[model samples]
Target: MNRLRILLADDHPVVLAGIRALVEAEPDMEVIATAADGTAAFDLADRLRPDVAVLDMSMPGPNGAEVAERIARYCAQCRVVMLTVHEDRAYVRRLLEVGVAGYVLKRSAPAELVRAIRAVAAGGLHLDPAVAALAICRDPPRPAAPEAAAEPTEREAEVLRLTAAGHGNKAIAQALGIAVKTVEAHKANGMGKLGFRSRVELVRYAASRGWLGSLQP
Candidate 1:
């Protein structure tokens, strides 16, 4: 059986160590690298292209979303799951907007983290139930579309494609000959329509839909 290759990213060494123990305990999964911040996470991910990346939402130089975005761009098959203490829907929304596939709270059991990793690796979305319930009750703003979650507008689609490709807003605008604000608007719309709660979800959805293939170098 092929072992699951994983990368761990967290600002806290203790937490990172704990996660490593939990993940590596599984015979089918192994930790190939560990990072203390977002930049390191991206570097390791780019170099190793692990099957799954477990990341802390708050980290130095790029944050979890940025790391996930970069991974999605360079390692299309890699799955990113945010391990965070944050329960805010806005934060979750941003992660989903970028196409991350999993969100596990830090307080959750190690088993939950394992579950999230397995789910994401299988191309499914996973969210801590507590966080998801809170989001459902508040009725947050929507992006992209409603019924059928129809394709975004041409510009919005372009932005989504670029976003999935790991391009920053400024970069996307420059490449697409649009204003930065316009790029933001389209990106927002794309996320809203998809009802993504975070950048992670957005990236996953775009990838699953094959939107990023066109943007690959």
Candidate 2:
């Protein structure tokens, strides 16, 4: 069987060791490298191209957001999972904008991190349940002009919500008991009505409206 290659980065030695042990204990996952700073993390990721890069939000050199952005640009094939202490919505929004696939809190159970790694490795997004609530309490989105665009219909809203929650078209279709083409149509109409051009924008909008509170890993 092909093992999932992982790269871990955290400045704390004991914490790093603990995380390494947790990941190494998984029979299907392997830690190929570890780093104490963001720069080294990016360097290792770019060089080794691990299946997933688990990073701490706060680190010396470039920081998690910067490293995530760089890796997204230069190492598109590698997925990023942020293992962080930060529960702030601002941090979550910024990381999502830069293409981080998973956001797991350091305070969460050890199994949460493993689940995050597995989710992102399988092309899914994982947000810790603790932080997911913050998405609902965030400040509302900035107002758009009255004539700018119409609001999304109820069906469109449903599609956008699930999309923002990181479900793909087929999954959304299955969950909603709709056809894939209809799911795509609803997604397109919702994004068009809201003037959203990207999934990041849709997610940010969802966060502002507290529509992401129901998300699960």
Candidate 3:
């Protein structure tokens, strides 16, 4: 079996050690490298090309969002998972925009971090429940204008909600008892109706409507 390669980055020594231990304890994951600052993290990620890079939101030199952006540009194959104490929607939006695949709160259980790494490694997005709630509270609904496209049908909405919750097409199909092609169609139609061109935009839209509130950890 191939174990998941992981790179960890954080400014706090104790937190770094704790995260390393937590990740190492998982049988299917291994920490290939660690950095105490954002610059080192980016360098390690670019060099090692780990399956996932777990980053702290605030670090010396460049910060997590900047590092994530750099990695997204320079190391497209390596996914990023942000471990942060912030539940701010602005931080979440910025990180997501920069291609950070997962956002797990530092205060969340250790298992949450492990789950986040696994999720992003498998090409899925993961957001902490608390941070997701911020979107619901902050983004008010906008009244649709007459020129806007019609709203998505029930099936499309259901598929989109599941997509926002980080389930890929196959997984969504399995869960909803539909064909994978059907799942894709619903997702495409839903995103088109909402004028969203990317998964990040779909996630933010879902969060705004409290559709992602059901996501746990």
Candidate 4:
């Protein structure tokens, strides 16, 4: 099998070294390049288009979210993961909107970073257990709770839960082993059944149901 190429960016030298050490120690992973700030991160990732870009949330120039946006625009296939000290839901929402595939906390980096890299690289979402619970709370699209007359099936609930947690349609499809179109279908059906008119409403409902913490796969 081929090795997984990773590009990492963090401002701190020691932390960068530590992460690099952890990644390079893996037999199937390789660190192709490292950057000290978001600008360097963006430049390296955009050019190299590594399988995954592991970035610090607060770098000097662009920041992790900004770098993720640029990478997604230029190197669409390169997955992005954030190593952040901030567990704020706002940050998660911003980066998720930019197509970040993984969100891992700095506190859990030693134990979780490798798994996060692999998961995102393989087109799946990986949220640190603690971060997953507090990171991003999707604003419910509707004001009131869903009308009791209709409810979603198990698959539909699964789709909405992941969607509310900020996975895009394609990511959700990959995670659930379904087609992108199928994800769209499930999301639409679930939304209609629950009186959720938009992504915002679905998110709110999921949050209300505490579905974000369901980080299965």
| Whole-model lDDT, model 1 | 0.76
Tens-digit lDDT track for model 3 on 4-70? 9999999999999999999999999999999999999999998998989999999999999999888
Model 4 pairs whose backbones collide: 140-204, 141-200, 141-201
Residue 115 alpha-carbon offset, candidate 3, angstroms: 1.1
Sliding window of 10 residues with minimal summed lDDT for model 1:
208-217
Superior candidate under lDDT, 3 versus 4? 3
Whole-model lDDT per candidate: 0.76, 0.82, 0.80, 0.77
Query: How much does candidate 2 score in TM-score?
Result: 0.72
Candidate 2 residue-wise lDDT at 123: 58
- TM-scores of the models, in the order given: 0.66, 0.72, 0.72, 0.70
lDDT value for model 4: 0.77
* lDDT of model 3 at position 183: 94
State which candidate has the highest lDDT.
Answer: 2
Mind giving the per-residue lDDT tens digits that candidate 4 earns over 89-202? Answer: 777667666767788988874768888888777656677777565433433244434354667899999988776654667667777899989998998888778776554455
Worst 10 residues of 2 by lDDT: 136-145
Candidate 4 global TM-score: 0.70
TM for candidate 1 is 0.66
- Model 1 residue runs over 4 Å out of place are 135-217
Q: What global local distance difference test value does model 2 have?
A: 0.82
